[model samples]
Target: MKNTTLYKKFFVAINGSNSEQRPLSIALSGGVDSVVLLHLCYTLREQMPGWVIEAIYIDHGLSVDSDSWRAFCQRLCESLSIDFKTASVEVKAKARHSLEAQARDARYAALDSLAMANSMIVLGQHGDDQLETFLLRLKRGSGLDGLASMRAQRILDSGRVCIRPLLNASREDIEAFARMFAIEHIEDHSNKDDRFDRNFLRNQVIPLFKSRFNGFLQSVLRSIELLQQQQSLIEELTLQDLQTCCSEQGQLDLQRLGALSQLRQANVVRSWLASFNEKMPSKVQLEQLLHQALTSKQDAQINIVMGKGCVKKHRGFLYFVIAQDPPQPCVDVALAPITLNDGRALIVEHGVGVRAPNNNERISVQFGLLSSKIRPRNKPGRNAVKHWLKEAGVPSWQRAHVPLIFYDEQLVQIVGYYFEHSMYVPQQGVRWEVVDGE
Candidate 1:
């Protein structure tokens, strides 16, 4: 390769890029690191075989020179024989999204929109950059997981993998390579402004520490590597535990979780929640979640509304789900219909499905149907099953998620509970099945 990275290891790791079915897309800020990565990928295009390189420039439109940066990137890509792309994105600094977060999100969103399925987006993050991130997390008083920071293979929301090829390379190496190649990288004046935390670390804070203690950078980086190793092990254990404790509908076991060490709980919760990719619960919210979920009365209804959804406890199962009411599965119930597709038919209600095997014993789960004409008697049938369960102590908040079968305008069966005597399967072989409810 005409232009290789300072360390051949990063290129090999990136060239391996793990998933080649996902092609390569580069974030070209026209900085030394990004430009070097773009050049390296372009030079090794033949070696990569089927790899496709797209240089994407995200102009935040925060400055007057932003347009010039885009043009520079386009020209640079043209010279390098790489496809060029540019996205004009708005960076919001509202209270909800801090400036740093907003810019990063917007940039990635733009990349995701442009990337093909399972494609990989390569970042210019090298060893020094990773060290800075680790230090930032350390300053926040986070544990090992936080210090682990970025990984080599993290899936993005767009279903693309964000791969950092230069993760183990340093700034000095990248700058040297850029100058050697006469690569024309834009020098953003903001880098000199020192208003950014990263810039402060690079310019002032880091130099002071370096003067006081030689090799401080490498020492701190070594500590981060150790933390990364520990964090990876914790994640592996947490996942194994999750698989063992997961409920049928992806619910977690609070008691099982509480039994683990407190530090392990944080690791488990973060890994578990991230598995769903939901807006994560904060540290305080996570603590509260553990407390209420494990310690609250077994039957007590615990509903936590945070981020993009809610976590609820129902019938000894823990649910982390979308905050919105999912439309009832569009299904109509039929009496004496035992099975569908070689599987038991489900009775559908508000937001749930009840599957009662025709020949199986009367299980612990209750069931029901909705019918204006059918009035099933409970132990003491009076009003409707709806009214009966509500009065019998089903919490109002929990009612919405419970399966309540409706026959037309009337409520007949409630799955898992009891069938309406009027609408029960008339014969021994007769069975009622739940389907999607409108």
Candidate 2:
């Protein structure tokens, strides 16, 4: 591509729908691709007047030359009078997960924290990187969603926008732009190690493919676009299926879900997990989940480990409960919202539910009192809290999270489930609402 054409592409990407006037944070690695991207943004600065342009280098600290690369990026940014920042991340590798993936997750998290909100995080990934990603997913037996590859623009779960202006440009196009402008860049020595799948592809597999078929990359790009379109249709169908099978509390109704074909059932589950931003389960894990959901005994407890949470079944419904810190042992209850250490809050409102505590009474909320007994609104007598939880169909693992409201030393309310029979009022009462923290 010509210099002017490349500039126009960057301009259009930054000026795309719902993206105008947002600051740009370029992911600089002191490599040709990113260096060229920074140069383009710097040259096009006049076109995007009043927009902030900066470069951020994330040091994974895995390579011996990591410090030098950060220095290089800092100098380059200074030469162009752009803001420069660096962040170091610890890549915590887990079993069955690749180091690359761990580093990527850490890098993205750091960027999310350091970048300005409502701004764009520009990446320097090109068409060659897209081809490598498609092949990598194919090697892992990924379905259509994975094979669809990267997009020019996407919004992260954190609501920050990311754009890849170089996604459509070929590697040769970027190199030519760099050479024509005599731009200097550094290379990471780790790229020479074929132990990495991407390195192996770039050095051995892709060159042969390019030589064998002159338009191989273009053909793959076209296929990716078609797959993306097909994936979009599937997403729409999954959403429609979800409406029938998913409850307002984000629980999946097994009866409704099982009515669909096995393929549709899996599709709905994947979409359901995606709605909660949960990592997609592997094929084997997904099959096991479906099997347990369909054939397990009605009273049998079901708990499947997912990313940071567990999938549990209770009363014919499946819920994804993330692990969270337990709430404080006790908290004073008042008119203002009471925020818990965990991502939860209780808003006590004046409504028809439980009777307001008397002026002399000390109102507080407590957790984990399974042995305590209380009489539900119309119940004959007090029953153990554990029995009340079981009767209410609360999952065994989640029974401890139920917030108990105390009037002095007596249990008067189960925040979300019921009110004490003696404390219940028909006219004026305090109703409690639970607000989930993100």
Candidate 3:
């Protein structure tokens, strides 16, 4: 509870983090927790030799005082001689998502863009925050991973490392440290509103719980630690199961996955989705996915949509298909990169590809020409583009997006799939490739 003890605890946590070599970007919200963290890190700057401590404030533009909050954080950083930066983001609400969720997503996205590459992001979440998150997840019927709650240090899917030095520090200790240093911070008016679940818990539920049980927080913390250990073991086993059932193309082999128990099957599905950085489906949705995947007819087409993409089953393999806009037909062709409308790039390069276009020929790129025929090099004869794509195991929904390169009116190349047999050259020649857009 003493200021010195609090400082020592934070120092030990940060010093042992192994992020001393990297710059630290504090997610400063101009609140008590963050202000205290900033003060501690800045005061101990002499001890952390390699750390370049800075503060980044993300303005969600939701509150009228958002700019004032940013200015406050900037001034605080200036007083401490710490670098300060701000990013303003528009929080757009989406279906089946709360405003808090949207704002949180926007805030993190702004942080990711504003922070330096490979910089460690420092968040000022305390023990009370962790307990609130645990309760919220529990209310939503979260599993082991959710119950494990926040990690002191976690590497995000974007490969950015985030650390919480105050995770184990109690709110009381943080407030005491602030009072001891006479630290200044702004109180967000939204914190007083009980309509939000977290705010309600922090303002009402937690206080009552603490009053009734002095050691409740400590017991919950121990439970979370134990849950984290169990979740880590589960993740290890899930990876092994994934390796056995997932294909090189990132598709899960239904037969292999079905061999596992129903619970194991669900675990594998969840892990597979996570590997792709896709959002996890609800319990009902996940159950439906498994049922359709295992019981559907062999020739049945399964297309279930979730989180920026749809999942499809093809030949017993479950594939995650990112939603792409319809490809627009292009009339020009050159030995350069052509940006496609469907978030893909058509690159034409000289290699063991198709022969170069003649001076009299007009080259162009087209899409949705599945009815057209093209003779692939080394193949027996010309076949419909649709049939070629089928033989190549291209999903039906994606066939329309495949770029078709033509010399004048003749089909010469299928961009990525194959080159026209007549125009193909085994030696040095121009070839085409399709890649994800930047």
Candidate 4:
């Protein structure tokens, strides 16, 4: 109850010496932990005049009392004369993850959208939440990154840094503070539902461990810190390896990646995918990907579906391409610019000092052109589109999406790859080019 000094010191340490200069946004869930957090920050605001404190409540709309929680949060914020905002998000479960995860995702997304660039967003995850996360991830067979558990501070994908100032504080600390201050907070009945893994861990497993081991939570915290240190070293090594294995287009060099130890390979791939904001592949999926990359023949094609995208290997490189719905077949290309389904546009340029297509010639843009015998400019022999794409180092998975330009059914040019020489007259007229649309 008299731990206000501890709360002040923790917040000051996490926020650094310039804590008073920047804006602080507290994520208020109308729970005891967050209510305590908000109260502490509100009190701190008086001592630090430069601090602009506000609160945000995210309503997932999954519970009947969500609206009541929002109103309670708003009233609390109003009583403290603090700015407040609310966001409603839909939580839908996906095949690969759980509803709890989906809801968390939605909650964070809403927070991210509401946060300003470079601002610090504070969350109410205390030691208990950290322990629960560690246990859950351990059960799921997570790697070192997962085992490291929640960080006290981390930068989110939205560029806002999230700081858990209460990470070192126990749930009991928060409850005591709330009770001492007579803080009013909403209670979510779902927290006690053992159907959720985290709830089960919190209500059952954690209690059993606490009863059996006098300082089990502290031991787990120490282990998490050690894992975090190890994970940091791995990340440093991954950065170095990425510099050597990543291409100009951000594709991973399969040859370079294959040369690494299996563990290193997985690390590099994980780092590569993380750069693209893609989800980390499961352990089994990652091993399968590495095996295929290392053992596949030079001519062998590889494609593995990932979250909302796929990993592709062609020639000696691996690339991640987002999944797109199939485009309608063969959209005609007129003299004017025409946009394709994939947001790339084909434009006909005339009188630009190159040979233009003949007046009788017709041009159309299409996908999956499989015909051969189309020779690229300055190349000796005709080759199939597949062979040409392969020779050009295009991944097989991407070939189907490449726009092929045809002159009356004769494949004249591959939009981004090759141009057929016969279609152009030297030192005269018009041409066509494909460009990415905004």
- The alpha-carbon deviation from the true structure for residue 155 of candidate 4, after best TM-score superposition, in angstroms, is 3.2
Give the range of the ten consecutive residues with the poorest summed lDDT in model 1.
363-372
**Model 1 collision count:** 27
Task: Give the candidate order by descending lDDT.
Answer: 3, 2, 4, 1
Model 3 per-residue lDDT at 338: 86
Off by over 4 Å in 1: 1-7, 19-22, 46-50, 211-214, 326-380, 387-398, 401-410, 414-419, 425-438
Candidate 4 vs. true structure, TM-score? 0.85
lDDT of each: 0.69, 0.86, 0.87, 0.80
TM-score winner:
2
Candidates 3 and 4 compared by lDDT, better number: 3
Candidate 3, residues 1-438: lDDT per residue as tens digits? Answer: 224988888887887784446778889999999999898888677655556888999988889999899999999889888999998899887787799889887877788778886788889998999999999999998889999999999886677888898888889989988898788999999899999899999999999999999888888999999999999998999899999999887899999999999989999999999887889998999999999999998667999999878889887889898876668888856678888876788776777988888888888888888999998987898899999998898888888888888888899988778888888887789988888977
lDDT of 4 by residue, 1-438 (tens): 324754765566556723545677889999998899898888777755667888999998899998999999999999999999999998876796778778887888888888655567888888889999998998978888999999888887766778888877788778878887798898989999998888899999999998999988878888998999999998999999999999888989888888888888989999998888888888889899999888989767788988768888777788888877545555445668777777877677665323555678776777786664587778888888999987887766677877777778787777667777666455555566778879
**Residue-level lDDT tens digits of model 2 in 82-162:** 999889998776898898889888888888788876668889998999999999999988889999989877788788878
TM-score of 2: 0.86
Which regions of candidate 4 are displaced past 4 Å?
A: 1-3, 17-20, 93-96, 116-118, 194-196, 204-216, 325-341, 345-354, 358-367, 372-387, 400-412, 436-438
The lDDT, on a scale of 0 to 1, for candidate 2 is 0.86
lDDT accuracy of residue 287 in candidate 1 = 91
Question: What is the Cα-based lDDT of residue 22 in candidate 2?
Answer: 74
- Cα TM-score per model: 0.80, 0.86, 0.85, 0.85
Compute the lDDT for candidate 1: 0.69
Distance (Å) between predicted and true CA of 319, model 4? 2.4
Residue 139 displacement (Å), model 3: 1.9
